[model samples]
Target: MLGQALLMALRALRLNLLRSLLTMLGIVIGVASVVTVLAIGSGAQSQVTRQIRAIGANVLMINPGAARQGGLRLKAGTRATLTEGDVDAILEQVPQVRAAAGSIAGSAQAVRENRNWNTTVNGTTTNHFVVRDWTLSSGRTFNATEEAMAGKVAVLGSVVARELFGTDDPVGAEIRVMNVPFEVVGVLSPKGPDQDDVAFVPLSTAKLRFLGSAGGTARDAVAYILAKAVSDEAMARAKASIEDLLRQRHRIQDDQEDDFKVQDPSAAAEAQRGATRTVAILLTSIAGVSLLVGGISIMNIMIVSVTERTREIGIRRALGARGRDIRLQFLCESLVLCLAGGLVGVVLGATISLTVARSAGWTTVIDPSAVAVAVGFSAITGLFFGLYPAHRAARLDPVEALKAE
Candidate 1:
């Protein structure tokens, strides 16, 4: 009985192929839109997760708050409220902290004989590498003597190495920063394109040769401090301990706001994921409206089909076909239409996602679950909207239906 109903449904659809195709357009578009948006969101979330992992887990960044001078406010990082002493205090007091380091940054031009490149210069201690999970690709990092003596030594990131040496080994070579020559003791492994365009020098070297003296009390201040927790579970404890310690050292009362800010790297990644999810939900909702519209179209078309087939339905009823059989045929028709539209939609959506990913150089992850959901939702839409029309056909009197033209 089911096979016969499905065969009749297919035959009816085949007779009006163009109209069937047009009716399914809405469902196709809605499903495609949902799939594409989900793919893009998944890709963005994946990228953010990988980047956070690459930067090392359980990391915290500390920066000074705004600075006030003569009743005017200065930029946040410019305040210089944090110094090497703050780093020491955090390490000594915060038992959850695995490693901590202070770093300063500046822009400088590097020259190696005829070649020159502009890159970011970072001033950091040996522990900065541990905090950031950075490792050398070749040669070696600064020794204790080199760091303490403020030696003229440097490490090149991959971009800097390529820009200056063009595939040649940068280690054991001499490079000049701001026209002050320094020996290249190491080359850091590649991080990413944006992160690799940099050079690292001993903190003392950066302070002495590049930053110079700020005069007065701000002389020893660093740009920021980076700390790593002993484990992922210890991040919150480490952060709290550092904050409480800094507040006490700065002697801020309960009524006063903190003079520094502590940031959790994982929080930033979670925020990004939340934003992506929100956008995906919004887009998918709009697409769902389209599917509703498509379902309405299916009902309208099915009602028209029932009207035109009244004589045939009457003939079948006279031949002992029950109302349930009539209803089943109409329901099957709706289901088949929706399933076809959904399949087409999946293909179209995947194609669009791949094209955009290639054209824009973006990562896209197509989830199989999204495809299944789209198809299932479409089937449900068909059943819901098709119910009333199917029942209407089933209720028609055989005698009256036969009396119609």
Candidate 2:
């Protein structure tokens, strides 16, 4: 009996193929939108997670805060208040600190032969690698001996290496930074954007050759300090200790603001994750509205279908067809329409997401659960909206329906 009802429903849909297709178009669009948005959102969240992991959750950044001069406030990190002493003090005074490194940065053009690319040059100690959790992809990182001697050695990030040396190995290659030649000692592993388009040099070399020494002040003055805690749970304590040590070192009074700011990258990462989740939920809600609209359209069409087939219903009833059978037939028709539309929408949405990821160089992850939920929701929509129409058709009086023209 069920199979027969489904077959009849298919035949009825076939008789009005164009209208059936048009009626399901809304469902198709809505499901596709939901799937595509979810893929993009999941991808974004994964990317953020990767970045956070790469940087390490136990890291803390201490930056020189804004300084006021003549009623004008300078940008943060412009005051040059942070120094190497602060980095040493943090490691020595803070029991939670595992490692600390001071660093300064400047923009320079790297030239090897005729190939040259502009990139950021970071001046840092060997401990910087420990704090950043960066690893060498090729060769080796410079040792403390080289750092102390201000050796003219450099490490290339993946992007800078690709730009300068192509497929050739950059290890032991000579590159000029601002006309000062240095041998590339190593290449860093890829760490996504912002972190990859850079070059690392010994702190002393950068201070002397590129950044220029301000009466030996440049060697001591660093833009920021990166400190890594012994464990993730110790980050807050380490931050507090570093703040107290710096405040004492800088001789700040109780009423005055400190000259530095402590930052936790983990907090920033959490905020970013929250924002991405909020946006995904909002977009999904908007897409769900489209599904509701599609359901309403299905309800309206089903009602019209029942009215047009009144005589058919009456004839079936006269032939001993139960009201439940008539109702089931209409319900099956609605379910079939929605299921077909949902399947097509899934395929379309997956295609669109893959295309966007390829063309835009973005990450996209299609969750099986999302697809299942979308299809299931569509089925529920069909049943809910088709209920009233199906019930109305089942209750039609055979005598009156048969008399209608």
- Model 2 per-residue lDDT tens digits across residues 1-405: 989999999999999999999989988988998899899989989988887877765899899878788999988865778887888888888999999998888899999998999999999988888888898899888787888888999999999999999999999999999999999999999988778999999887888778753224445888888999999889888889988999999999999998899999888988998898899999989888988999999999999999999999989999999889999999999998888889888998899999999999989999999999989989998999989999999999998989777
Full-model lDDT for every candidate = 0.89, 0.90
Stretches of candidate 1 off by over 4 Å are 1-11, 213-219, 253-256, 314-328, 351-364, 387-403
lDDT of 2: 0.90
Candidate 2 ranges with C-alpha deviation above 4 Å: 1-3, 213-218, 318-320, 347-364, 396-404
In candidate 2, list every pair of residues with a backbone clash. none
Q: Candidate 2 — number of clashing residue pairs?
A: 0
Clashes of 1: 0
Query: Residue 74 in candidate 1 has what lDDT?
Result: 80
